[model samples]
Target: MSGSSKVKDGVSGLEFKISQISKNPPSLLVTLKNNNPSLPFTILKWNTPLDPQATNLGLFKLVDEETGKEIPMDGLKVNRLIPPSKEDLVTVAPGTEEAHEIVMNKPWLPEKRPASYNVTVSGKFSGVWEKYGDDLQASDLEAYLDSPFSGKSFTSNEVSMRVE
Candidate 1:
């Protein structure tokens, strides 16, 4: 399944695609496109699926199609610093896109087979910089956090798949 979100909150698009769902472990491709014409779109890497452990399954939501019940996800809950470092952010150039791949394994899939599931991701595009000060001036983390994308929640288009 493949889907994309419309422009919202200065974000161009959030594209989601599942390749070979029938496979034991499907590949989930998520791309974030920058709408800014000049400035590069910078956001916390922990906000994306790329850092599932940090997000603690907060990035993706999976529901059983038949039962209409939400599938539970488990991940490591990371304790981060007040001001994130430069390496903790992802920068998408203006008019460009950044893509990340996630392998859907047992943690993301239902135990029972031959079932269908719908998946969607929802979270803030960036961290809440307003609550944080420029404590780490050397990292220049405050600059990236203090953006229009900060603290803006977005939900991606839902994609469905059948597992045999």
Candidate 2:
């Protein structure tokens, strides 16, 4: 499934897509495309679901279509005391896309398989740096934080899959 969202300011937009890579163990490939022609888009890697360390089970919502119940995710939640650093940011260059693969195993998925399931990516992109500290000051970083894409919540199109 694919979903796209245009920022309110029309300065940037993002296209998100999800495709099933495997069925037996259940894996998914997520792709993100930057629509801006001149500027690169930045996303908080710690909050983005595309990163496995970002808590994939919590960021991606999974529901059983037959039972109409949301599947519970068992995972650890990490809380950082300090603000996000430059390393925590992912940049998608102008008119470019990036992809990542997620393997859903025991903790993310129950031992028993559901007949059918619907999955959607949902999360908020947020983080601000009051002090650049040792990090390099760039115009692109300032532009991204000032843009409408910052601190925005997004939900992708729901994709349904059948489990045998």
Candidate 3:
């Protein structure tokens, strides 16, 4: 969560949390009220990354597993980051064989809902720009999840999100 705490099997060990979810199905259903009024239809929730204390590349959305020609929510937003829990993640959330080499997750989204999920990694900018910038296409789910870019790596770089 903080810095790349430990390098394992050629990749950084990491975990991520749900930054925000853009829509709420029940609210977005457009209910007919007594006054015939519409109200807010979205909600946001927070999480303590599955693993509490694994340190890795701060937080970088490792190209989502769901692939397609979908556009990213916020390009100019630089990058979304999360705060490190300071607890040891290894014991809380054990590492896997496959993920031992790759540092990403595929969150299973609910069905029949129009929602956008933004995962806040543990770090700030610099890396997202240096890695996913230039090629705006890299921000694309499909492109970022494809070959080459999918295997992209950076030097021992670290960035912190200065919450102002």
Candidate 4:
């Protein structure tokens, strides 16, 4: 390791906040054409790339933009990786970009109300360790990750309008 590499092992964590919502973003747009409220909206997340050997991590949180309430993890119906069985893997190199798409399942929310969502980084290492998968087998480790690493607060977006 001679030259300065912008890529660091700790870089695999998400320091920035994550919020996915369009201001006046067409929350109520429908795929039916001339329809009200979109049937199913999705949440997309890009975490710092990391190896797949890390501990239990990865899951974007959902919050009510207005109520400041933390939505249940169940509502987050999608994931990037489901470890222990082998799967989720990304590198935390300079340009490494890991992503996750979570579908919003708040059917109880009014079809035309304002809401917001914020992403939560659930690990100390940004879960971006490039050697996570390999590390899974290794006994020696050198890092500390607190539970519930990072979280962005509720933002503001709207649901589709009622189709009359």
Candidate achieving the largest lDDT: 2
For TM-score, candidate 1 versus 3, the one ahead is 1
Residues 1-164, candidate 2: write the lDDT tens digits.
44454344322356666777888667777787776677666665656666547444378778888889998875567774344557766667778887887776646565666566888776666633322223435554545456445676666667775565
- The model with the greater lDDT, 2 or 4, is 2
- Model 4, runs deviating above 4 Å: 1-17, 21-63, 69-85, 106-112, 117-164
Tens digit per residue, CA lDDT, model 4, 31-68: 10111122221111223212222112233334555566
Steric clashes per prediction: 0, 0, 5, 15
Stretches of candidate 1 off by over 4 Å are: 1-3, 7-22, 52-55, 74-76, 128-147
> CA lDDT, every prediction?
0.59, 0.63, 0.23, 0.28
Q: Over the full model, what C-alpha lDDT does candidate 4 score relative to the true structure?
A: 0.28
Candidate 3, which segments miss by more than 4 Å at Cα? 1-4, 10-134, 138-140, 147-164
Candidate 3, residues 84-128, lDDT tens digits: the string is 111211121123211112222222223423333323333211111
User: Residue 10, candidate 4: how far off, in angstroms?
Assistant: 7.6
Q: Lowest lDDT 10-mer window, candidate 4? A: 27-36
Clashes of 3: 5
TM-score of each: 0.72, 0.73, 0.17, 0.33
Show the lowest summed lDDT stretch of 10 residues, model 3.
27-36
What would the per-residue lDDT of candidate 1 be over residues 10-111, giving only the tens digit for each residue? 344333233333445555666666655665545677766556452365577879899899987765566777666766766566667777766666555667
Best by TM-score: 2
